[model samples]
Target: MIRLGHGYDIHRLDSRENAGQPIVIAGVRFDGSPGHAPDFELGCVAHSDGDVIYHSVVDAILGALTMPDIGCLFPDNDPRLRGADSSIFMEEAYKRMVARDYRIGNCDVTLICQKPKVNVENDAGESVKQLMRENLSRLLHTPIECLNVKARTHEKVDSVGECRAIECHVVLTLERTA
Candidate 1:
């Protein structure tokens, strides 16, 4: 059996936290400057690392299994979860998938943000996308060929387009292994 699931997530970009600290997305860091330069000035504000891409992927897997969402499984109010790694969420979702005898067939992700262009043209954009793909492949235990990552701007229409927030959408295909 093959099942398709969709996931979406968005987080506000805090202008305050952009000071030198790097914001993690898909386990990769995006900072305003290299080496945590104090001049760095843009990052997402959230309880976790605020990696919308990873969060969306986890949601996709949980949706595929008809399980609770990430917020339910890992509440923001939990102190222990403060600044937690998003990969942990992905791992839990993957475990659930395996328990159900399901494996990932493919996954495609679209990230929307105006400030950080995710193309190779930008210094850090393309590399970050590739890091995400590699990390996701490892997390899902799937071949790199089965995963896809794309980034875009919202054309200045909404929060993401305005560079005030970051959003991600994910589509996951799961196949029954047994």
Candidate 2:
């Protein structure tokens, strides 16, 4: 049997937390500097590294397999998860799926943000794809081609439109291989 799951997430911009650091979305880091800050000045805040891409992906996989969410498995209330690396979370989710004899068919992600330039050349989608593919491949014991990632801009109209925040949506398909 096969199941499909979709997940989405958004985080507000924090100039204080990420004042001079590069904005990392979906594991891809965007260079942020004065007059050249990757096109957006805002970022998300959380107990962990705040990688929306990884978080959404984790939720999508868990939801597809009727498993616990990232927070439920790695609660924010736990000090061990503070400033935690998202890759670990992804690995753990994949492990849970494996324990249940489920295999990942494919995963897709869309990132929506307003600034730091919407152009692909500056948005860092490729980097994100590479990282996700690598991590997912390791966890699922599959090839990297099974994962896809896309990014879009909100047209600078609303909160995301103004680059005040970033949003990510993830979809995953899982099959019971055993």
Candidate 3:
């Protein structure tokens, strides 16, 4: 059997003063770019680590399996889940997928943000994307070639474009392994 699912998530960017924690996306922390003005100090605001990419991928897997979403499984109100790592959410979804005899066939994700360019000049951007692909493939137990990631700026149109938020969209294809 085969199934397809799509998921989307967004979080508002917070100033360092307002955000009690650092920004984490796709399990990678945003440690401020040295090239940015006086060091980059932007981050997402959320109850958890605010990894929009990871969360979206989890939702996609759950959607493919016709299961409850992250919110349903880990409510924001739950104190135990406060500051929880997003990878835990992904692992939980993976357990469900394995139990259902399903494995990821392919995954494509897009990130929408303005300020933090996906890749700066030189090999920095490419390196980041490669690292992300490797990590995501390992997390999903899928071949690196089966994962695709793209980033785009919102062109200063909305919150994302204005550098006030980050958003991610994921599409997943799952195939039964049994």
Candidate 4:
């Protein structure tokens, strides 16, 4: 049996007071990049670590399996979730996938951002897309080849284009491993 799922997430970007780090996507810290402006860089405004990739991926998996979404599993009103890591949400989805004897056959992720170019190598010599692919593959126990990540600018049209927000969309094929 095979299942298909799609997920999307977006967060408003704002200036964080005295935040030393850069925006995090799929657990990668992006700082001082060809897309980062130290003086004007923006950060995601959310209760938890705002990782649009991980958040959307989790939702995709859960939605595919006919389960509750991240918001339902980890409600924003929960005080314990304040500033929580997004990876935990991914973990929960993975556990459910395994319990249901399903595995990711393949997934494609698209990210939209005006700053922090995804293909450009940051100061760490790692391209943001590659870093995200590796991180998500590791977290989901899916082969790296089964994942594809692409990013683009919002063409300066809306909040994303203005660099005031970031968004991600994910689609995946889930196959029965049994």
Candidate 5:
């Protein structure tokens, strides 16, 4: 059997955490500096690390399994979850996916942001999209070849395009291994 899931998440980049607070996407940090830096003067207004990539992936995994989403399983109201690392949420989702006997056949992610382009390499000489693919593949135990990440801009038409927010959309196919 095959199952398909789709997930989307968006978060504001201001009015909460100040800029230069570190904008973590997928698992990489784009921080420091001011106008010269990517995601300059922007920070996600979220209780967790505000990694839209991971959050969307988790939601996709849960949706494919017909289970509760990230919000339900990890409520934002919980004080313990404040400043939580999003990878923990992703690991739990992966565990659930495995428990249900499903493995990723293909995972595609589209990251929308006006700043801090996802195509550029970080200070560590790692390409953002490749790093994200690697991270997701590692977390889900799927071959890196099975995953693809694409970067996009909102065309200066919305909040994401304005650099006030970041958004991500994920679609994945789960195939039964047994």
Candidate 6:
């Protein structure tokens, strides 16, 4: 049997007054702009590295297998998880899937933001795909071809359009291999 699942997440950028460490997105770091809003000061505030791409992907896989979410497995309330690596979430999710005898068919992700331009030239999509493929492949004991990733921008309108934050939507298809 096979199942498909989707997950989405969005986080607002930190204002200059409350700026913190730059949040890593799609494996790229966007150091909050310096100076009292000199140019840009935007970052996601979360317990982990706050990689929306990774978070969304983890949720998608768990949702498909009807497993617990990232929060449930790695709760934010736990001090050990504070500022933990986002890749750990992906690895854990993949482990869970493999334990259930499931294999990943493929995955696609879309990132919505107005700034830091996510495009092929910037290697945003490819970076995410490579990271996910590498980690998932190791955990699933399969090749990297089973995973895929992509990025997109919101044509400047709403919150994401305004570049005030970033959002990611991910979908995954899983099959029972055993």
Q: Give one digit per residue, the lDDT tens place, for model 6 in 1-178.
A: 9999897878777763554656566555554222111123566777777778878888998999888877788787888877777878878888888889887787777777787554322223244335445554565455677666566778888888887778999888888988
Residue ranges of candidate 1 with Cα displaced over 4 Å: 16-21, 32-40, 121-126
What does each candidate score in C-alpha RMSD?
Answer: 3.1, 4.1, 3.0, 3.0, 3.1, 5.1
Q: Work out how many backbone clashes candidate 4 has.
A: 0
Per-residue error for 156 in candidate 4, Å, reads 0.5
- Candidate 5: residue 125 Cα off by (Å): 2.9
Cα lDDT of all candidates, in order?
0.80, 0.71, 0.82, 0.84, 0.83, 0.70
TM-scores of all predicted structures: 0.88, 0.80, 0.91, 0.91, 0.91, 0.78
Which should have the higher lDDT, number 4 or number 6?
A: 4
Ranking by lDDT: 4, 5, 3, 1, 2, 6
lDDT of 2 by residue, 1-178 (tens): 8999887777776774564334666555555432222444455566777777888988988898877777788898899887777878878877888888888788887878766443344333344346545655765576678877677889878988886777889988988879
- Among all candidates shown, the one with the greatest lDDT: 4
Of models 1 and 4, which has the larger TM-score? 4
* Number of clashes recorded per candidate: 1, 9, 1, 0, 0, 0
Residue 19 in model 2: lDDT: 40
Kindly indicate the candidate among 4 and 6 with the higher TM-score.
4
Distance (Å) between predicted and true CA of 122, model 3? Answer: 10
The better candidate by TM-score, 2 or 4, is 4
Candidate 6, residue 162: lDDT: 85
CA-RMSD of model 3: 3.0
On residues 2-106, what C-alpha lDDT tens digit does candidate 4 reach at each position? 999999999888775533335778877555545322233666688788889999999999999999888999998899988788999889899999999999999
lDDT of 4 at 115: 78
lDDT for model 2 comes to 0.71
lDDT (Cα) of model 4:
0.84
